[model samples]
Target: MRRATSLLCFLIVMLCGTVAMAASPVNADGYYKGIKLCGRVKVVEHFADIKVKVVDSFPDLRVKVVSSFPDDVGEWQFVEYGEDFTVQFVESFPDIKIKYVNSFPGVE
Candidate 1:
């Protein structure tokens, strides 16, 4: 009985960890324009195509970019605007990744 209880606890912990990791946001230093690619995205050994879009508002009829793409779908970490940034665009998905203060950044 004790062994079974311990195993159950371990499984519960692992399940929670997996959920948290999946919910984690995309890792990026900051937002930028003109690049149309995420600076933090590491070049994979195998290349997978990803599509994204920039929307006007959140919960504003735009689907999550990652969900739409099967290959490049990953967690996205939204951050506050700052200087010294470049912008990238996902062609198919239409969920805004970066939000700017002054003007909308260009995405290719």
Candidate 2:
């Protein structure tokens, strides 16, 4: 009986660890920066709920959007990655240009 209890405890710990890992997003700087290309083009269901995670290294950036809208609401926007970032909407809402301030990481 004691051995069975110990085995069960070990299984429980393993299961908890797996759950935690699955819940956490991967942090990769480059990956997050890459997603920046999506910018305004990405039609996120809840743009206000967007989360960006940036780390010192390119391999430590995470981005996610949590929204209460329906599952089929938002479509991920796609744009080309470049030094300068620009967002263009289909309508005549005016374009948003993001000037490339710097690229050396750690800049404000």
lDDT of 1 by residue, 1-108 (tens): 999999999999999977754442332322222222322232222232322344454311112232122122222323333312222355454323433222232221
Kindly give the number of clashing pairs for every candidate.
13, 10
TM-score for every candidate vs. truth?
0.29, 0.31
TM-score of 2: 0.31
Off by over 4 Å in 1: 27-108
The best candidate in terms of TM-score? 2
Kindly report which residue pairs in candidate 2 clash with one another.
27-60, 27-61, 28-59, 28-60, 28-61, 29-58, 29-60, 29-61, 30-58, 42-77
Compared with the true structure, what per-residue lDDT tens digits does model 2 show for residues 4-108? Answer: 999999999999987754443332222223433323233322332233322333312222222222122121224333212333322222221122212222111
